[model samples]
Target: MFSLPQRLAAEALGTGLLVATVVGSGIMASSLTQDTALALLGNTLPTGAILVVLITILAPISGAHFNPAVSLVFAFRRELSAQEAIMYALAQIVGGIVGTIAAHVMFALPLLDASTKIRTGGAQWFAEWVATFGLVFTILAALRFARASVPWLVGLYITAAYWFTASTSFANPAVAIARAFTNTFAGIRPADLPGFIAAQLLGALCALAFAGWLLREQSDATQPLNAEAKP
Candidate 1:
């Protein structure tokens, strides 16, 4: 088995690259296009594509759970211990912050700044819940019936969620928190984080409950998204 540190490192590195791709692509997209739709399109593609690659490459190590919500959900399902989930959550948050900083450095912007994009309201909260519900549901369902398609399924779902959701699908707590530190196109206001995160947690729980009901427990079932792990 890979050591805890090794698993943590993979989670951190994978999350960092994922956020870098998100923030960097948003910046580049905004710079290249005046139309908001076009810029969003540009931002969506690379983030989705990178998600596939990162999850596929890192699934063996840490299940590539770059989101705290995902780790928490896994813990609830007993796929991961509570301690491991907490450690993964911390690593993901730190990695997300570092990734945001890296993007700022690459773009020659300020290292850290609170976002001014005021995203709040019941509609936004509901959007977050929907987005996260879809995300966790996708992960649970795909990992059960179509293990090989998880990367594509998750990537494509997020890509679509980005456009369909009102809040642009910041379905990840760590991503939302790290993004709050940036005043970029993809950033969210820090004050708005509590509601978003609460909604995400709720959504994750709902998805887990639904998954338990939907699938009959099987001894032969794979270990969630950690199917690629090697001893």
Candidate 2:
């Protein structure tokens, strides 16, 4: 295992790459597809595939926490230290900015304008909530029930979420912030960011509660077996 700083750095780099690929691909897909559903599929399928690969490759090194909400949830579960969670969250935010800047340069895209990016309305806020809630719930369950197989399960969760949730299941705060830096179809306007962020955070909190319940149930189930084995 890596030292804390090394792990944090790996997480930052991995998350940066993840967001860059996702937003960059979304831009390309939207430009290519005139149909909304087709464009969404084009954007999210590749994003989900990349997420699976990245998590598999990076989880052992950095815990693969590409989102602040995810880091927070892990901290609550005692899977991550509070100090590490804070550091990881900061790294994720900074990495998001860096990724968006790189994408801008690579694509020769015009600088993002707050006026032109997509607005976050009521529907969008609800979408953010549902998307993030599903993501966090799925991740926590996978960790608890299939600890050794979380990467593949997480990948499937993301893929299914993309098809089901609104906001294309952009559940990661890093990805949301990064999207603000691009004026593409995937981009969210700065003016509309607060609502989306608030919604996602709320969803994360709900997931935490659910995780606690699940953990309690597991502990209760195991206690009887432990007692029976005592001398």
Best by TM-score: 1
* Candidate 1, pairs of clashing residues: none
lDDT of 1 by residue, 40-127 (tens): 9999999899999999999988899899999999998898999999999999999999989999999999988799989999999999
What are the runs in model 1 whose C-alpha is more than 4 Å off?
Answer: 217-231
TM-score of each: 0.92, 0.88
Query: What is the C-alpha local distance difference test score of each model?
Result: 0.92, 0.80
Q: Which candidate has the highest lDDT of all? A: 1
TM-score of candidate 1 to 2 decimals? 0.92
Clashes of 1: 0
